[model samples]
Target chain A: MGSTATAKIVALPMVDKHADPEPVETKASAAQMSAAEIQVPEPEPIPTVSLTKVFLGLLGYVTRERMITALLACISIGALFLFWYLGTKYRLEFYIRFKNVPTPYEVYQQLTQVGLSNKYLFNIAMSVRRILLGFMIATIIGVPLGLAIGKYERVRDFFMPVVEIMRPIPAIAWVPMSIMLWPNNEASIVFITFIGAFFPILLNTIHGVHSLDGVLVRAARCLGASEIRLFMNVILPGSLPHIFTGLAVGMGVAWVSLIAAEMISGQFGVGYFTWEAYSLVDYPAIVLGMITIGVLGLACSGIIRMVGVLLMPWLAFAPGGRR
Target chain B: MSMTMTEAETHKGFIDVRDMGVTFGANDNKVVAVDNVSLNVQPGEFVSLIGPSGCGKSTLLSIVAGFVKPTRGEALLDGKAITKPGSDRGVVFQQYSLFPWLSVRKNVEFGLKMAGVEQSKRNTTARALLDLAGLLSFENHYPDQLSGGMKQRIGIVRALATSPQVLLMDEPFGALDTQTRVVMQEILTNIWQQFRISVLFITHDIEESIFLSDRIYVMTARPGRIKAVIKVPLPRPRTAEMTDTPEFMNLVQELKGLIREESLAAMAPEIKDRGLSGFGMKVGPKGVGEIF
Candidate 1:
């Protein structure tokens, strides 16, 4: 048991890329050094926590507890596959139709055939680029505007109404107006994507600022922080965790907007490919395009999560991290 | 006002509140949190405000800290009106108010950094202060990683890093367990003795007030007014053994009596309004057994 524990400690996972290495090493040595001094008749080796590696962390910082969570995630996805296989094989048509839908193997066949094609690859690249560009622009404009709206009462009064009135309107509803407003299809689609991502980021940021602890501001002021210094030191850091939440939610919305714009007016994008396949009666191809979209959407959100982890190093090993 | 007090002779942390009152809302909804009250803290003196829960002890402290404006009069620090919060007065709150994002060392260094101190200087100052608090080893840890007592200790150390003239504390140990609170009281007195900075503390604990303060101000409940001003005659570098002495116990009984009177008065209006002032009324299904 002792040897296994030592090996486990030796293979400890990293919490963050910038996690300080000194404590982890010292704790490890301390635990090992204490082994020879005590000979109590305990059933198991008493846990000596190496704080850096033993607790939960983000991305590549997988501990044994997180591994079980990962395993459960895999099982959930596997269940979905099992349902899909059964549905296609039995031609189930309980409420929704799956009578003529292709099996998972058939979809895989379609993926191998056209997935490597220039058109498919090109469409995937276009959709990803559009979403990323739109998201970057949205974040740049939304975060500061949100911060301003959150900080000053007058700014909130002016902007919050416009945001509130426009927020509930679907991005797809703006597609026609966006097309007329911009010079080209790319600009129009990007605009629609921006509209999709912007409001959540703005609203979340406002809420974040509004919810900031008043006592913290008092504490900061009493500590001699000037107005600018208070904003930089307290206000900015306090709202960052919320901003990232906004970013992740924005990324998801941006994808939905991207697909709508691409399906309606795009020359090339995964959304266009999926819609075109439907028009051409290529069932398997449509499924394959959808799968591509799902994979890419997951990838986009995963990247946002990792960035959130990177920015909030304090939250890296915390269980809930942030709300 | 004394004629002989020179500008240099008047040291830092000399607080003066003259007829200060703070009222919230107005007209029909008007609530007077603090009434016309006057008090002063001598430079380097340890003072405490003790009262019932709603007696505006915290409001008085907040006025001194420059967080709340006085509706009637003024609060002065070292002979100047406190127009706004400044580094000259540091505050420690009851909530253990350290930024969770910062490491313990960084939390301590926050005030110094705000004052434009260099990184190396911040480090050394923070380290020295953390050592003084007996938390030098835990400097690298975050606030969330520390226990309640540790967080409050860091809060004290952080407040002192700027070399502030006065420390304004509002029941800082109110949330801690009894054991931790006693230990913290000792730790705080030690820090106070070391720096000799003036402290204006607020607490509901009578013993805490008597134990820590050179002078104690007892206040009445809502629209709070100063009820009494008492001096603690305990010698310097006070020990736990001092608490058991007849003098200390006598002070405790005195403070408790003062506070109990105000607490009963605080409840009287509400009881009258609710029409539950008399014991003749039936309560809880008309039987004591049913209530129990």
Candidate 2:
């Protein structure tokens, strides 16, 4: 067998990359006598750290293509700022009902001044508080309700009709009714925010549960998991990815509802400040409000994403962390 | 060893199915999956059910695993009726059996945890089983990170961690590549030897059934019934080298003939239905004859 294998290797001079290593070693087949003589190569020596390796390690898989896209995004944002400066510098109106738009510098100047004001900070805090309160309540009620609705046909049938009816009504449309229903202005605004947050969370949770593989449930049962155990071990974790997605989407809608409600009836929120600025003809404050809202919303979603990553460590295993 | 051969053959088994039949729907829409199938697995025996597709081999295994109810007959495990799934019977599904959310070790320890076993004992048992599968190094890895063969190995280990009376595998190697499938077969045989538990294996692979089983039960086409039960005369501690010998090849040839006959018969009706779809025309020369 050894002689025949040697003869074959001579006959076939080129490398057979696809050849099974068990029968013949790749680089050392000529030196080997038999399959058992196929030796394992020694592990490569650890080399001193290279700058490129460290750089790549710090930012795994940041392809040149992605960098190009990031650069383009930055350029577009720069052009927007330039256009705002140019437009206000000359007071140019390029149609589309353009008028009295504040210059980028004017907005920046206003932001610098308002950055330290106690009333501005208080308004931001108040808005954050209302949004958090509403969202927390929505999550507590919606997740369990969604799980029940998804798990049982009876719960689904009972709740679905009412949800469907209420789902399509915009949160702003509920402003009049919410004001009448709630005794206080704060309660009305929070109610609107809750309405915005609840439906998406509920629907996504239901979808998450419904879409779980039935085989997992069967596997759990055969493994001796009781019904309650099955729910905890299989159903909960199985549907969590979808639940997080629901939460992220719900957060965005909640902000939109919260801002709208505050504009309509709020006395001391960021939204109310923007509306007050418009009433008092303070144009720079309006742009400041928009910037604040955008920054706050991004931070809110970022926190949710961090929480999701922590909860689902398996799915979010960073490159070079654990393979 | 406690029971006589005759008694084990006729009365008791780790997994026993008696005149089992499962059918879905009613009236015109009805589909008969299994028809009057009966089989038994003695303690420490390895049994394989080989048949054409849609031959109810999986349905039979599901009955034994207590996933599906038998429509016409009954299945029992250790003299107790198999009503619903329990930890007494461990099942390894063909694919996606491992929980994606759990690490390999956690997946293995799941049944132990559910059984209310204490934390330390559960971890030790899971570690031991993972070691048996030669997967102790990959314990922290999620199922998503493992290859097809590795995932199935974890699946088997997870199933065995519960220490069930019988291990029910449903085409566990069907989705694997040819090379991986062969390796998985060897690993399974090794596990079976060490564990010494009854296994009711299901597969369509003729060579696989012959290589792994103490007895191979061949089933007919739809409304599947036992067509033959050939006891493997091959010696224990079977190896890949045995496949080249006349005995193993002869068994493979014999099983292949039986299966091909059933497979052709199974495809014949469907081929005709396809021909009928062409405006009730007769099947031309480009019909079932050319189909493998």
Which 10 residues in a row give candidate 1 chain B its minimum summed lDDT?
B1-10
Prediction 1: B-chain TM-score: 0.91
Off by over 4 Å in 1: A1-64, A90-95, A316-323, B1-10, B273-292
DockQ of each: 0.23, 0.28
lDDT of 1 by residue, B1-292 (tens): 0111244433777999999988999899999989999999999899999888888889888889988888999999989999888888989999988987788999999999999999998998897776566566678987777667778888998998888888899999998877667657766875676577789999999889888999999999898999999999999766556898999999999988998889978988777666572634435556656645
What lDDT is obtained when candidate 1 is compared to the true structure? 0.82
Error of 1 at B71 (Å): 1.0
lDDT of 2 by residue, B1-292 (tens): 1111233333334677898889999999999999999999988899999999999999898888877888998998888998888887889999757888999999999989999989999988897666555566567978776667777878998887777778899999998878667656766775675567888999999889988899999999997999999999988666556677999989998999999989977888777766654535565678767666
Candidate 2 - chain A - TM: 0.78
**lDDT at position B216, candidate 1:** 97
Best by the DockQ measure: 2
Candidate 1 vs. true structure, TM-score: 0.86
**Candidate 1: clashing pairs of residues:** none
Q: For candidate 2, lDDT tens digit of each residue in A164-196?
A: 999999998999999999999989999999999
